[model samples]
Target: MSNIVLKRWKRTEGVVNESYTHSDGHHDQSTQLSEVTLTGHLGREAQSPIEMTKSAGEAASNGGDDSHLPNTLTEDNRNEGEAGGGVSPCCNWSWMVVLGATLLMCCILSAFRCMGMAEVVEVTVAWGEVDPTFVLLRCRQLLTNIISSCFGIIFSPFLLQLHTSSTTITIIYSVLQFMWNSSGLFVGPLVEEFNWRKVAMVSSFLSSCSFILSAFATSPWQLLLSFSILGGFCYGLMTSLSYLIIPHYFTRWRGVANACVVAGIGIGQMIGPILVEFLQKEYGYVGGTLLMGAVLFHACIGASLLRPIQNQTITNTSVQLVEPESRTSGVVTAEKKWTTVAIRIFLCVCRNIVTNFSVLKSRRAVIIAIGGLLTFNSWLNFIALIPFAVQAAGHPLQAASTCVIVSAVCNLVTCLAVSMLSDWSKFSMKGACMTSTAVIAASTFAFSVVTDIWWQKIIMGMWGCGVGSYMGIYGLTIAYYMGVHSLDATLGVTQLLIGLGFITIGPIIGVIRDASDSYTFSIWVLAGLAACSFILWIFMPNTTQHSHTTPLSPIT
Candidate 1:
């Protein structure tokens, strides 16, 4: 007769969930059991959820025959399930979504980083003699893609014709930067109200419109309307939405998924300059602006790929549940009740904003935000600084561009490799952040002293390694520190910090270069910023304790 027996079989100092059927005092068929069930049985035997979950994961990973287990046991999913109060399985086709996201990310980053940065150089060249302040202001603003290709090319001629002062241009871009950064605050509510895919599609279409509007802009204010206000808002919306979509699809490969998506930024950085340069050269800036609009419009194609996952249970506490309104016996006319509904909605929104802002109260969120601010600001400066530094060291502009490409390649590779390692191995997210920041500090210091073209390329590669590694884990770090539910709010806070840094410190770097007539001091300052971020990261709270008190396990 076939019999069922519940047993915890320990072999050579490790636990394995196997059901051995014993009949007639002899063993017969043995079948593997689910890790979730195994953990529950162990839990009754006084085993902590964290310890049992980790042991089960280790056993599965350490060559245990888990072929019979469900495929939902993804890399980060274990922790996600434990913390979330139930074991959820990942969808089998999630990889298809990842592929789509990578393409979407490529288009987003290309427009946001690559095209934005290139436009600054193109605009300056087209206008031929502006205040040194214009380059500094626009370069920094464009880092987060406040300006697009069409935005700059269209505005360059108008500014020249109108004789607008650089100070006025700086003020305009500063407002754009603020708008871009502040728009993040609204993302969480928008995503909650609408499907993420719908929000992305609408924003992508509007972003393309912004670029097209810039191509025909006649005045600086028109440029602001098309490029600064509209473009900046759309970019911020799309960028935040991209980060939010990944965690929903893949818990098992969350780290690797983040790396793959962010690698699009590297790809865009590498390809954007060359493509825009060719378009502007071949078609002229006006035609280039129109062509660039055509390119930005393709983001809609990327947005179309973000299909929503079905049949998933969301246990995240951050996803607030709304209660249905009670029915009233007395009928109220629509016009009479409109004001009451509007007032109630406004009050509800205010509560959400207050609750979301409370995420900043956690030390973990603050450190993540501050560290991101320092590291990101330092890297953006490097993008603008590297070209000037190379020229200062006697290399041509071509050499500088080549060095930027080298950094991008290294960034892409390291980002992928490190993210995979973090998933497959026991490397902590905090450790990855610390190690990469140190590399950036050392590389930046070395670049300040090195003059040879080969050394510059090598130094740039090292710099990219640090930047990419940090970026790879940035989203994971947020999910780890705070729950995934708080990700939008935390990301919004980080964007605000980075934006403030751009406006305040970006121009200071330019002034230092101009006054000192050397990039050496400015480079040292950036290295110092990297060092500061490393130190700030060292204070990150120990989240391991949460595994015991809560069902979630710390991400390995």
Candidate 2:
């Protein structure tokens, strides 16, 4: 008789279903045990679902259960059972339908958000009518993104599951966005007239009735309450939720999945501003909120599609769920080439971090931390300070904006190139970290010493490249250094340090700028800090030293 045992693990640990192979075909003649009977990843002991809480820290590369498989998984499937009927060309096309609807839902959500972006610009803040302070419209966007990003990342892991994660996350995103629409347009002003409690009540009411009300108030504090209370709750929940779902279904196509979602942001930003303008112009800002509310109410229609993953159980082993005829095949299908590539890229990145640091075993934790601190600080400062620096250096606002746009585009392109380069060169993530540090320092020096507009533009472009590349590299290094499974925690810890870096940098740079008659000295000081940061990164060791350079094992 075959034996089975279960194990407790964070879902990211993909090996819950380890298969043991015999040296000889010892069981070839035994009564054939159906592979479908041994469906789950068994461990030494069965673990209750409740015990599967997430592991703490930047522990290791992680993976979790993939519910369906068409071919040999692990080069073996453990038993002799007939493959399921789903793979037969004549099989019904239902799975494709499920997948099709899901992709459509995702696309709609992306497009609506894009329209809303353009709409936000049209909101005429009665700056002249009220307290008369105008927070630059674009500044709020950056802040919203920051706040949403932090919140989304932290909440994302919690949303993962065999089913329902995507839908739950979508509802949360829609609801929060609806609330944001109301406040940014109207409730924000109304609250300026009342107490904080009243503001809170009004904001909550608008969120509850967003399908009906759509509105904000007057004072900045009113805006803060709406955003912090309603916005904070929603933003934190959705950001992480958005990225993880595609990985669940399509590990091989992580890049494509990520691209699809990111494309949503680009689309949303474009449309949102336009929507805001239309609403504000057609019926006053108040009417705009109401119009937006009308738009938001329709989203709940899509929410119904976010259901539990189909309760699928195949009595046969090795089912290949194929849907060539269905509309959803592309969105729902799996292609192994990219997944294999992903695994290799992962290996390549891990090898780099380990070989460069030379502390894989004894100093695993330390190296990951060092990677987090300097890398995040050096790169994250792009939006935080670089633009400010350019403004201080006497450049036009458009020039600063152009540099940011170009750099972001470059980073997107390098997301693939750098991953491949690291694999090809076999340079430790350590090298990448150090190179970024050097770039930051060099760029900082150039910014400080150069005065001519042309030179400054060149310097900005150089600094922007560092800024862009570092952002993507930092995420990749953190994943490989700590483990993809602990990516959320790695990101969190990195942010903690980054937050500190921002606090220290803002004032130091500001004070230096103010104290000196010109920004020259301040730029040099920033460069010096970059140099100090790079030196600190030198001691960071590779976590892979602790294990063979595969994805780091999940912390037990």
lDDT of each: 0.62, 0.37
The residue-by-residue lDDT of candidate 2 on 246-308, one tens digit each, is: 322221223333444444444444455456455556776456555655554343332233222
- Ten-residue region with minimum lDDT total, candidate 2: 66-75
Residue ranges of candidate 1 with Cα displaced over 4 Å = 1-93, 113-131, 140-164, 274-291, 304-350, 545-556
In Å, residue 362's CA in model 1 sits off its true spot by: 1.1
TM-score for all predictions? 0.73, 0.51
**Candidate 2 colliding pairs, count:** 56
Q: Which residue segments of model 2 deviate by more than 4 Å?
A: 1-53, 57-214, 243-284, 287-395, 416-428, 500-504, 542-556
Cα RMSD of predicted structure 1: 12.3
lDDT of residue 367 for candidate 2: 49
Return the TM-score for candidate 1, rounded to 2 decimals: 0.73
Predictions: Cα RMSD each: 12.3, 16.8
